[model samples]
Target: MIIELIVCFFATVSFGIIFSVPRNSLLLGGGIGSLAWAIYRLLPEYGVTSIFATSIASITAAMLAHFLARKYRIPATAFTIPGIIPLVPGSKAYYTMLAFVEGDYIGGLELGIVTMLQAGAIAAGIVFALAVFSFGKGIGHRYEGGR
Candidate 1:
């Protein structure tokens, strides 16, 4: 448990470095918590299905971060990208590139399709969350101009 927490902390710091997140600790802590939540879902009885779950969980965390940023007057992109990095389908992208480099055209094509699907899945999850949040915020609400 202690090791896992430490790993998550360092992973979060690495993400902060890679993404150029500001040194403020709250964003760093949020990244750690979000990543840890995804990794926690990556275990248990679900096995490989956990990857999909982690992707969805990261999207959810990104959405929550977006909301908090909006409510607290911070930059939205600052929270969204780092929060989602843990679940990015980077391995699949690398495999796709490797297949292409090895002259396995068919395998490369298949991997390309899989890579696009994974990207689409991640995008769909984020869009779904944003749509729901927007609907909840404005569905029946009146504007200051008087609806």
Candidate 2:
């Protein structure tokens, strides 16, 4: 588990470096990635399914991304994209495609569906997080005019 967290940090930092993310934000991005990954890994031990775990982690990533962006004045995506790198279901997608190539149509179909659902879950989680953050930010404020 410790190794996994370490790997998550390095992986995110590497991603930040590769993408030319601003130098000052790399450490925080790596931290968000590690924290998101930690939540994803720990929830499974408590009986949560992978899809749900992924969603929760994604939500966490987005929340941190927002905070990081606000605090540092960097675009939230600088953190969000790197933060979710470790959460991508690359293996499942690869296996799904491999199943298709190997002439296992039924297996491929099942794997493909699951892969899509997982991907959708990640998107949904991010969207939900954005909505929650937006709502929170808008509290005690009113839109007065439509222009």
Candidate 3:
């Protein structure tokens, strides 16, 4: 578990560097990725399906990204894009393509569908987080206007 967290942190930081995220934000981005990956790894022990686990992990990352962005006065993407890297289904996508290359149409089709579903779950989680954040901001603004 410790090793996995370390790997997640480095992976996110590397991607952050590749993405040109500001030097000051790299550690926060790495921390977010590690936390999200921890959640993703632990959920399976409790019987959470991959799709649902990915969604929950993504939600975690997105929330952290928003908070970090506001705290640091930077765009959320600085954190989000790298934060979500640890949760990406890269191995599954690779296997999907491998199956196709091996002429296993049925296997490829199944993997492709699963890959798409996982991608959709990630997107749904992000959207859900954004909507909740926006709603909360709206309520805060409404009350602040009376001050």
TM accuracy, model 2: 0.89
lDDT by residue (1-147, candidate 2, tens digit) is: 999999889999999899998898899999989998999899999999988999999989998898879888888888888888888889999999999999999999999988888888789877887787677676667677883
Q: Give one digit per residue, the lDDT tens place, for model 3 in 62-145.
A: 998988888899998898888888888889999999999999999999999989988888888778878877776566445555
Write down the TM-score of every candidate: 0.68, 0.89, 0.89
Q: Each candidate's lDDT (Cα)?
A: 0.64, 0.89, 0.89
lDDT by residue for model 1 (28-131), tens: 54554556455545554566554466556656766776686677676765666666665566787898899889998899888788677656756776677677
List candidate 3 segments past 4 Å from native: 136-147
Q: Could you tell me how far off, in angstroms, the CA of residue 140 lies in candidate 1 after the best superposition?
A: 6.9
User: Positional deviation of 11 in candidate 1, in angstroms?
Assistant: 3.2
Clashes of each: 0, 0, 0
* lDDT pick, better of 1 and 3: 3
Candidate 1 Cα deviation (angstroms), residue 19: 3.1
lDDT of 2 at 85: 83
